[model samples]
Target chain A: MSPVVLWVGGLMLAAAAIIIVVRIERGPSMLDRTIALDMLVGVVIAALALWSAAAERTDLVNVLVVLSLVGFVGSVTLARFVAVEPEDEGRILTPEEVRAHDGRMRASLAKESKRRVGGREDAMRRAYPESEDPR
Target chain B: MSVLDWFASICFFLGCALNLIAAIGALRFPDLLSRMHAATKPQVLGLMLVMAGLAASLGSSQLTWKLTIVVLFQFMTAPVSAHMVGRSGYRTGKVREDLLVIDELTEDLDRAKSTPIPPSSS
Candidate 1:
């Protein structure tokens, strides 16, 4: 019964993690992706503990302990690398700057997006038979 | 299935569901810091539930004690990890002004802003 519960629980967590991965993939910036990575490690530890208990295996405890330490180290490294200004003293971004920067990136990204879509269509046309509509 | 098995399985399912909710919260939230809060809390609770279910199924004092050790350490350390990540996120310039809550870290940065730590020193 315990093992069954663990298996179900792990599967549920996995599904949730996949959703997080999507966010990571779609993140507009590096920091957004970093948070997702942090969450992923947390999920891993939880799943491990559940499995260890379900299996009646005390031997797996070490894995959780090691991961706990390792996850913190990894987060610290990322946070340090991605440090932001504290939101005070008028130093944080104003609306205009954000708009300007986003506009520039969007312009570039739009061109890329269009090019990729065009390429996909071209590939599709080549893969299909002549009788198939290119549309 | 035995009574013990049935109870454990149900609890395990509940824990898994809670964990998934936490992950969804982490992803669906608009900003990174908010996402961290969502990421940490529910996962710990979910893990606690999972460990308890494991103990029930295994039915060994020694194993239960070990499982408890892992859970205890995880709970204690998760906050530290969050803090480090938040600190680093701030240092590297990832703080989003549009969705921020408290500004305690700003004070921290101000206090330490004057003191320069050479990267190579570490």
Candidate 2:
């Protein structure tokens, strides 16, 4: 490959790597981070291919194989870890679900308050019958 | 420039571009499953393109065979890994259910839990 092509490919791949790193740094969830890391390994493989092509070292193909294997294992392990942890599931609620939950809580609170107020009025009427008489 | 060099250069650049796009998708996607989809789908194509570019430039038969093995290995593993990650993400609640238009897994789990298991012959 020409030096110009190699340099351009390398630069593009490097830029891609930077974007993936940003994702890893700021991903909102652990799974998102894991996905980013998996992509990093992929980008690394491409970079390694570019390097081997530029450097005329075919043995890096072996490294590429190993990296792919390692990446698969890592992703599978992370997935397994996340799968078994049920408590973490449902950590993110959608806007509609959140709103509905909030509404349900408010309604329950209102019902409880209404019950309390009605009981208090009943007690007052029983304690002072004349107070309840219409003036 | 030779035809081979042009082909190699074009494939290499396109592959790199795909990688960049995949990265953008991974970063900007709203949830884990979408991010996983973004990270894996284009990445396989990118890897193939990049490898094809490199293999085109190599002179020896041995190096070309090695590249073939790498591509095969990548294709075999990428989907399996992505599937595992998506399943785990779904199970662990990394996915936002409200965003999903259809939830087959939840329905399956519900049906399984509601039914009684048959006695094993063993």
Best candidate, TM-score: 2
Tens-place lDDT per residue, model 1, A82-127, is 6343444323357998899899999999999999999988898888
Report lDDT (Cα) of residue B104, candidate 2.
90
Task: List where candidate 2 sits over 4 angstroms from the true fold.
Answer: A83-135, B116-122
Give every collision pair in model 2.
Answer: A89-B92
| DockQ of model 1, rounded to 2 decimals | 0.41
Q: Give the per-residue lDDT of model 1 (tens digit) for B1-122.
A: 88877766776777778778877887678766777778776547876777677777777887778768867777777787677776666556666776756677676666676578623322
Worst lDDT window (10 residues) for model 2 chain A?
Answer: A83-92
Model 2: fraction of native contacts: 0.77
User: CAPRI verdict on model 1?
Assistant: acceptable
* lDDT of model 1, residue B31: 69
- Write down the TM-score for model 2: 0.75
- Give per-residue CA lDDT, model 2, range B62-109, as digits (tens): 888887788788788888888888877777666688899998978877
